[model samples]
Target: MASSLRLLLPLLLLLICSIHGGRGQPCSTSDIRVEQRTTGASVEGQPEYQVTVSNTCDCPQSKVMLLCYGLNSVTDVDPRAIKPVDAKLCAVAGGRPLSKGTPVKFKYAWKTPQDFPVVSSEIHC
Candidate 1:
């Protein structure tokens, strides 16, 4: 009984480690493409836009992280206004899974006038 218990304990530990280790490693930056487009036009000093992330890899991706920053020489608009379309799915705890050729989108609105366009954005999985 003692020998069997010892063997089982190591196997259990290995199984647990493997399960946890396989998570949190999102796809590489090179495997994804991001694009931004204006939804319509600036409304009442605020601008609305949509950002899309496309998976270029052949496999499915999970736990994706997206960070977008705004750039404008005329005005200083808060970049944090850009948010995931689905807040719950894009939360830090876990992100939505994206399959190959599929894309995920986020919507953003600037509180102030955005004279410049979004020139910098990043993604990680």
Candidate 2:
């Protein structure tokens, strides 16, 4: 009985690890994709750009923060859509969980398009 139990335990542990690690593919900042394009509109003499943030992971991601140092738009954006966390980061969707297919979008006006790289997120599988 003891021998069987020992063998069973190791197999069970391995099975659990594989299940968790293999399921849904572990997500990270790389799973977040950012796309920005000119909207052909001007705000306060600055060209407007539309930004879309999407989670490519199979699972939902929450608390999605992006690098946004020195991000200032002459056009006003809703705080709930995106807000500054500090000098170097900003949170998206009010830090709510983003679904796989649904994307969060917002627009800003500037002389140049701002780049938003994913900084951190909590992946929910």
lDDT of 1 at 22: 41
Which ranges in model 1 have alpha carbons more than 4 Å from their true place?
A: 1-27, 68-94, 111-125
Q: In model 1, how large is the Cα lDDT of residue 68?
A: 31
Deviation (Å) of 105 in candidate 1? 1.6
Clashing pairs in 2: none
**TM-scores for every candidate against the unseen true structure:** 0.45, 0.79
User: What are the Cα lDDT values of the candidates?
Assistant: 0.49, 0.86
Model 1 Cα lDDT, one tens digit per residue, 16-64:
5564344334345456566778778664566776666666754555555
**What is the per-residue lDDT of model 2 for residues 1-125, given as tens digits with 9 covering 90 to 100?**
99999989988877766754555347777888999999999999999998888987777899999999856899788787789989999999999998778899999998888889888999897
- In model 1, state the lDDT of residue 80: 39
Q: List the residue pairs that clash in candidate 1.
A: 26-125
